[model samples]
Target: MTNDDLQFTDDRPITTQAQDLLDRAGFAQRLALAVSSWKNQESLVISLTGGWGSGKTSIKNMTLDHLAAVQGCQVIEFNPWQWAGQDSLSSAFFAEISRVIQREDPSDDDRKLAKLLRSYSRRLNTGASLADGTAKLLPILLASTLATSLLGTLAQGAVAQITWLGVAGASALGSLSLILQRSGAWLGRWAGNLDEDAKDSALTLSQLREKLQKLLSTRDKPLLVVLDDLDRLSAEQMKGIFQLVKAHMDFANVVFLLLFQRETVEQGLWKAGFDGADYLEKIIQVPFSVPAIASSQLENLLFKRLDEILAQEPQLQQRFEQDYWSRVFQRGMRPFFSNLRHVYRYSSTLAFHCRLLRGTEVAEVNAVDLFALECLRIFAPETYTELSKHKALLTGSDPYSRQDEPQRVRTTQLMDQLVSLAPVPHQAATRQLLQEMFPTLDWVFNNTNYDQGIQLRWLVNSRVCCDEVFDRYFEMSIPEQDVPNSLLHELGRRITEPEPFTILLTSQAEDRQAEILQRLIGLVEEFPLDQSVEVVRTLLHAGERVGRKISFTNWSPRQQVTRLLRIYLQRFEQEADRSQSVINAFALTPGLVVVEQLLGADHALRRKGDVGYFDDSGLEQLKSVYMRKLREKADSDPDAFLADGDQASYLYDLNSYSEGGDEGRRWVEANVTSPDRFLQFAQGQVSVRTTHCGGTTTRTSYIPVSSLESFLGLERWTQWAARLDSLELAEDQCRTLALVKEALAQSEQSVTAEESNR
Candidate 1:
């Protein structure tokens, strides 16, 4: 393969590689057209615009290559930024062009150019030359004469003084003109003879123009001068180069492909006195924009390239799975793989890791894995810092809305982290964590109205986190006094969680276990309402298995039940209203049974002279009565009992009533057979009541059963029963049942086996 076909493996210069690719890619036709347009004296400037990685430089190099090889075009490519000082930019440009001409064509023309350059060099080196210095200064003499005449014309009887002043001015001008003219002439004469170093130093605006004009006049074929790396140049130097091309070389038969970033070029031109568009029009005869390859196409390109590498190194082929390649391409290439440069960097890093694993048990590289690894290496530090920064930004807000804060902060932090982590070497554990966290963060940020701007500010501040360990630690570590208990609480919460959890665990298994229970408890407390009981149960189980004592000190079983029941009721009511198939299934299950059971008891107790007692045969009738009372209560005043204190007190009273004895357990068991039944019972109990005759009197009733069963599932119910059985016989079981009822009322889903069994 030619150099052009070979992607860069390192940071070496790519001039040769770029040119080869240009030839192979069949870009010669367009290149020649560009050259011809210049030779025809159509336009002096052309812009080679491309997206981040579209081979703009390669095209420029191709034009330069063609000029150097087949076209006999003398091309001088100068990147102004490479030169430190811009004091003599014009001279330096001329010098570079002269060198290129000689380098490309070293014959009779070269000889002529060489002789002229020698004279120029000599003149530049020395103060005087073979020509009489006084005679050579004729332009100054003419200027002085003109000045004297002008002065004499303006004033009478001041001839001598005016003459003297004019003479002085003319002499100064003459000397300046002589120096400039000689410099131009010498540059023209030796335009092709200068070495790279000399060319670099001798480039000047005038000299560059002279060389271009001379090359156009003398060269047989079309000439192309590719001014590349203009983006690297300082604002002033770029402006100067552009001005020289526009003002002096406009009519020359030389095509100048000025390579630069669009933004940089526009900005530079704007900073100069010229109107960007107008100035561009004057110089750029043709403009072409290079767009990024479509994501699908780019992925194909990566696969094709990887296939070639795999073919060459068969052993390396086995390391990666087919899906791995796709994953890596999707993950890394989607966001920032805009150019060949990015492709090269990504591939090279993969190759580097592949090489490291060669000749060992380590097989072919998993592209996705490698990509993630590389991302971590490149981005983890930055991500970590950004997270900290965003956290800080969030901390700065006063009376922050708890609902809005963490999501916003975490999303911003994750985005910044993902961007940073993208270019690192792979570490499986870290990569997995990042993948899970980043996408979650992305979803939150996009779907919700998080403070994106503050997040960005925090991200900018996070640059410091990318430093080495010492720097990162120094920058992110919090002070002892200022550290909030909530922060520790959050971290602990993460440690105990499983998949979809954000806790980062250390490699030491024992260590992970040691603090896990505490973390789990903290997380349960921190996110009790947001997290499912199943999650809390799993955490508790995991902690217990590792010999940790699980505590629900802040976890109110009644409150949890109440929350679950409410959620279930809302869902069931909505489904029932819609008359969905799910509702039919729900009606047949424990939901209808539970609702009927509670409502029956409530009605019997309320009935005049009717004892609230029922035999086995009257169970159905009793349940219907309870259900009716619940419906009545609900229809009475829905909002009155929803108040915080009222609900809490009601839940507490229900807990007490349920602890009355075997009656409570029997009541809960009858009601909570499924999620739906638990919800109905809980909703019935919590619904407020008012007098039927429209009187303003209100009564708060504590329904005996809690809906915890729905929230904790069957397993938790068994566990709570076992625990209660261990405590006080029937009373604890009753209380446990009541709590379960309350939990089921408030939750959206069932809890885990461990919580139920506990």
Candidate 2:
């Protein structure tokens, strides 16, 4: 068949095997004989059972399809699960059978008979109106009609004998009995609502037996019942179905054919109170298992199906190779033949992808490549990143210090230094440092399988390289036009200010550790900085141990060190409260100039009662005084200061600027000395805004500062102007009055000199 034909057939129900097995004529003959014998004697029960995807439903349909040719026998089909949870199970069951009987034979009398029977069943079950129940003697009416017909023939001088009359009466009774029994059997098949009352009724095995007996009389035809999709029911529901069937085993000439996946059915039964094998023997009169098809046969089937699909769309035929079809078939179709649902799902997915690839340059699809792509889609970026990090750590070189190897001391020292920056416990810090330095080397140490380790190592190495690329992209100060197409570039565009790496590095003193931190911060900010704060904290905690000790004697280097200390302390203070450990760490640094500068600024601002108006020089002087006081305290008694009663209060007073109107603006202008400096400070405090009187007394304020035009150079003015314009305040307002005053003074001096020369 062509591919198009295969696609079309995929939409149709599968019926070729069933039709082939039971040739139409032979099946019809067998059905008629079965129905005839069942009507004559009700002691037989028939069940049709098969595994999922087997033809249980199809066979049942086929049996009913030929029932028209049978004499004195009727066919009725009832699906119990459909009647689930309704109170009157018996009434519903009888109602369905009555409808079916009326439809099969629709004479006026037949319709009346069906209506009477249905009403009778409802009255019996629900204690409802009894008019219909009284009319249920229609079967007796039918028997009397036959008796009258027989007597009428005798009255016409045919000389009918009494023995003949008895035989006829008996035959009529048999037919009526069969009809009534079927109607009753159908009623019993209803899965009664499992309310408290129904639950109690369910436990009464005798009631079920009596109902079953009334429905399936001993002289009636054995009923064939097929239960499909049993796996769809919950364990309790499944148990209910089984219990119902078992309870009525003696009353009905009924055969139950249960269909489901073997494992699902067994598991469900186990959950519902019976052991697997025993439950199967009790409920499933015959269990048929579906075997997995051979890999080659599955391949053939797939190819056949594909051919049919491509027949309508002939262009698709050339898109796949013979081997490709075989591989896909083996991977998706060879696992479980009983699970037709999975088979269809997998095949459909493959077909869809194949259809998508049709007419492309690539002639064949790789199953492994497709599978990997699917897996990647299912997993997330974070998972991949973590896996890569772990791989790098496992395969990388040792990072821990080795006491025996003195020659490796420098490397060990470097490792130790890196580890000290991380805040995690010693072992974790060491591993993290090693991961950063030689990411892929950890896999070797991990003892993973060679292929897995190598693959993981590749991913790890790739991630590390990507991180480095981002760092370099950020580090290089290029014209906005020259920005590299990298993750850092994307991150920079997202942030209104400079990259976090740029901020971290430029905001503090230049040092090796600071530079590393700048890079790390940039990467973290790109994804989610808050989420990665723990990692950054770990790094910083580790790095603190290796830095040089602060000293006041060497003022130049000491100032730089002090600045770094201030930056760290400010960051810690901003991010977290002044914990004893953090405060102690700050006190350990030798120079208090930086800390003093910050505290003095706070005090000066408080003294002025207006933080917004304090100039840069004034703030700097305050910081110096605060730093000096901090140094004095630390020198006098560092341990005592850490445990001091006023430590928290002092830190609070130092950090806190008065919250008066325009205080934030005053602080910005006071602390920032130059245009560039002011801009940086402004960018940091951009979010500062104050409102009063619920919008009635609102005012916008900004710090006034001037740039050193010569220092910026003519070429840089445009960039500076752009930066200035981006601020929340007006561009003209940021120009300081002091600079204008200085310019006027210079102009006056120039005029005086010119006049004298003249």
Candidate 3:
């Protein structure tokens, strides 16, 4: 069973009394001691700074227990992320502050302080919302109403007096009306109220500060309000939290501990248009960075978990025997396991692959190498893709030379380019780990071999880095389709037999052949001797059917892949079948027809002792051995072997011999004796001469041959005539008659010349 089915945790922080990080560097004790010794009413802002996943929350818990138990202080935990999308962090924080400070059966002063602070918090929110406009405008509106009331009373009195003295009061009435109008205009200008607004703004702030002082005076224990996850909030909420803690929330007996990644918090501060560094410095009086987990501590913890996980997987256990291989994995893995969470992330992900690989065709790929690949998948995926797509660079030589040399000098250089192109910022240590893990990629100390190349091919072929892979360990909201585990198990079971393998492979379409070939190749090493033979046989059959495409240095992958499989397979193959081994090698990837033809010609020639039989060299290697026999006979006495070599057309077939196309034909041409026999050899083949259609293309058609060119004579013409006469009357003999006539004319010319000589 694969470790994938086993229960595994994916990098979640430990909340219970988990001794995962066992006080490395005595960090917990030191931090707890520091917070415990703080003086009362100092009102310090201590920043617990660490990168994400570096045990910040654990440290916070340790410090909290220390403060409450030893230091005798009241601790309040404030999570700003809870108010994520809102704009009320100031109100929410003070509410938390009020809840903690207000005792269960509060004394009168305690109740008064809580009430005062609560009221102040509300007014502070209101004044901020209104911009103190209503506070300033209130007194102005009251005074304006009183003045209007006074004016009406005076106007009524004047009108009564004016009615008593009719004509005389008419002149007085005009001046009074003008005075009232001017007075009304003066009151409206006072209603602009700019000056009153400033005074009221100062008063509101002063009143809140007074209430804050009263609240602090009532508290016996110093208030330790711990603010966490400020970095997790949206911009508006983050701004509110920062402003609340930095400016509004400060008080005499309250110490605020802000816990977040400095970089993330600074980014939030940047969005809020505050000078992040300066703002943090002003608010945070004491900055305590989380002690980094040392390499030794990481190794101890990582190995403990790895041992636990790998205990069940015997396949992975095999890797530890090779000292250098084990060291390579450990050294490469060190950079990734910086903390407990990172270790969990890597181990849990690897476990899934380990489970998925068990009893599968690809299980032959070393399990430790698979783990290293998992690390790369998490940290440097683009590099992973490069390794996957271009395995040829690892297997063969001089492939990347033509592909822009300046850019592709060394593997590390290519890696640096790839890492730089990634959107996420990966550490330089990750690049180092990648290079160390894949040592056979290319270097002087890192000389890559065929074995390493084969291992790389497995990594690329596994297709192990995808969303479905991620869902195994990581928590995702959306469910993904599981990998075809049932299908995989069936393939693993069936690949051992030749019939099922052949039938299943051949039935798969051409596109699916490559994937099947990759799976079968991975299984080559893991299989028993008999099964290995079956794989070799099946793959060879496929090759013969598929033929060659995308040529390697000498042959295509059809033969190249077969070459690797058979080379490894032969170790387990029986020596008694060594002769048959060569034949099977030649015949199956579906066996090479070229080798069968060569073997046939060799067998024919050997009966008369003209050539010795070829030994058990593989198809490509044996071609050289086979070629020597043919060349020996041809050089020593070409005429003797020609009768059979001619019958076995492969001897003269250009593809069978190296650089023998023109040379072999020329040898045959030079050694011919009788004109009629040579003419028979040269007959019926079209030699084309064409005009150019383009740079590389040419016009092609058939051209007729002449009698002298074919070396036809009187004997050749007589033979053709006899054969034609023997044929059916309706048979096509026009071309045969034409050649005979030409030969007959040539024979007459020759005879006439000979008679003149007599």
Candidate 4:
């Protein structure tokens, strides 16, 4: 898939005209008809309730769309959650109704009704009705009495001779006068001119409500007001909306439609101190619960989109296996998608990251395994994150690499904790999925272990369970110094073409070259049968140059290339075929170092009592051919042959195997006439020594005195050891000589200690 195909789903509600994947369109239409045909003059409050993300909004939008065709009906939508305070909610609700009336119905009486509605909303917000005024008047009088008593006590403290009772009586009279002046009817009876404006203001709320009801009753069409996202509001705000609908705004010819999650609203209402179910039942004249989407329909929708995404990647299709995918999908991926939003989210995540992986071919991941991991990534993000951090524990790569009894028990506990991060219902399925991907976990779950051979196959396929490729699954990109499997796969295809194959190897960075060669070595087993000889030839040629400089303490580029040859040889069924293929590649190959290493592996295997693809006679023939080739190269250009950095060890091996150790020493002595030659000779003699200190193990490369004596004899070795510091030696030669002298000193001390002990 290309980057252009990478897009994320925003989880937007499906448009009213768009095709409904959840099969709720029919119910929405029927509900719309019921709403539009309602003949009741009293305000009808209809509620559409469901759980969050259960497509309540979509069904509501669709029902409104269907209601649009009704001639005598008008719709007004207000999102109460957008307003923070109760006063704002009440004002915005009435403003929305007034806006609909002014925009849709331009009649003078309807305009007057809209103005009355706004005034009524303002009066309700201000708590200015007669009942509210009377209810608040008693509290004012009580507060006034308490303030006067406190003032009287303070005045007596100022005037020491003043009587507290007499002061309190005068203060009470002043408070009563202020109350009468403010109220005019309750306290202003003796106050002058109880104003007409004050009286009119007191009755304005009742007048507005009666006029609004009369005007709404005369209207031909009912106004349907939709209050959506009610469940998203705070308890107080949501309760205010309910109060505004049930008690305050119950005007004739006006229907209120409330959209929210039932359980959420109920809990919020309960938190506000009331029986939520009873309050909702009293407010709602008609309640409609959103229908539950069918699981099969959701599954079909999810798979159809997944298939569309899969179709963009042909390589993914080729790698896709039906049986394994079916098992993983049913057990692992299927459980995560219960609703339409879940499906969209998973599909978007898969598409976006799959595009990234496809563009890079970072891990050569199996498409099905990637799908399962994405299921965890979306549904169980914590588990996915834990998997990335605990790669060794999950892949069994480290201390738990071998599943002994103790390790198994420990790993089982860790695995149980890991799987428990998923939802409770999905824990079992997630564990099973992990087992299917990582066979190392099988022992913990199934009391069995897969053959170790299968892990090599997993590496070949770039399965995530393979420790080397595990990071790519989580990282979604390649790490530094790692080679792309796409390039390695291309190398396999280009094995027949020497120039392109060489170019591909040369294109990689020096550090990445080793990784590329290593991955190519792993892929050798899967190279086509017809390209076996050519593949072997190409790898040996590449190895001579690519593998020459890459050396670890225990592994050499020579061993790496030889391993590639050996794995490729296994494709041949008969021993004769393997021998013939090796001989054929050696004949076609140009490098002496890689061929010698390949034959050296065979000789070593034979010494270990294994046939090693070449029986006794065939091994001798290949060695003879190798010796002849080496002699020809040496005879043709001795300087170039000696200048070759990696040839020293191979030459020593040839001389020792064909002739004897004495002849090998004579040849080495003759060749070591210059400092450069001696450096090359010393570099070849370098042996890696491993030492463990504290908890760390380290490998140090140094030439040993005993090993030097075996190649150079006692007298010649002594001559070189005596003048080691005097000569102008290179860094590597100097280091080697220092190591040899150190070894000699340690050996002498050891011998003396042994004699003393005896």
**Candidate whose lDDT is highest:** 4
Once fitted onto the true fold, the runs of candidate 4 whose alpha carbons sit more than 4 angstroms away are 1-6, 84-92, 105-109, 112-148, 154-220, 248-253, 308-324, 361-370, 399-401, 423-437, 473-476, 499-514, 548-554, 615-620, 643-690, 693-758
RMSD in Å for all candidates? 19.1, 25.2, 12.9, 5.8
Over 51-132, each residue of candidate 1 has an lDDT whose tens digit, in order, gives: 5556776666555555555555556577766663733555565556557667754877665565444434333422222233
TM-scores for all candidates: the values are 0.40, 0.34, 0.53, 0.81
lDDT of each: 0.46, 0.42, 0.55, 0.73
Backbone clash tally (model 4): 2
- Residue 728 Cα positional deviation in candidate 4, in Å, after optimal superposition: 9.1
Question: Lowest-lDDT window of 10 residues in candidate 2?
Answer: 372-381
lDDT of 2 by residue, 1-758 (tens): 44333331232224433442323335434644564554422233344444555445554555555554454255565565676665444566566756865785466545654554454454445442233333455666677677767665665333556656676777777766765675463334332322323533433434543544564563344555445566666777667666655644554454444556567766888998888668767655444443343445544554455454455444334333455334433443233333333334445544554454333322122222232222222222222233333322233323542323452344345445444443332334234424433433333334223353334323222222232222221122222322122332333333322234334334334344333333223233233333233322222233323233333222332233333333333433232321222233333433233343344444556678854222445444444444455446634753454344334333333334333433323323343344555444323222213566854755453322222221232234334445555565445435432233343355456668999999
> What tens-digit string does per-residue lDDT give for candidate 4 at 1-758?
45365567668887684668777889988888777776655898899988777888899888887778555378888888777653356756787787787886478987787777666655554443344446756676787678767766576463542676666677678767766666665333222212433443555666777888788888877888889999888998878889878874467878888999888889999999979999999889889988887889998898898888877766677557788789888876777777888888888889877776774433367788899999888888888888888788777779526767887788888778879998897888788777777876777778876674566667767778877788889888877645567787788778776567877787765656665666676666657788667876776677666645444433555566667667777778787777777678878877576777767777678789876767666677777777777767765765676667655565676566666545456666666766566555666666777788999989887666665566666556556678666787767677867776776676677779999999
Better of 2 and 4 by lDDT: 4
Model 2 scores a TM of 0.34
lDDT: worst 10-residue window of model 4:
188-197
The lowest-lDDT stretch of 10 consecutive residues in candidate 1 is 461-470
Candidate 3 TM-score versus the reference: 0.53
lDDT of 3: 0.55
What does the lDDT read for residue 389 in candidate 2? 31
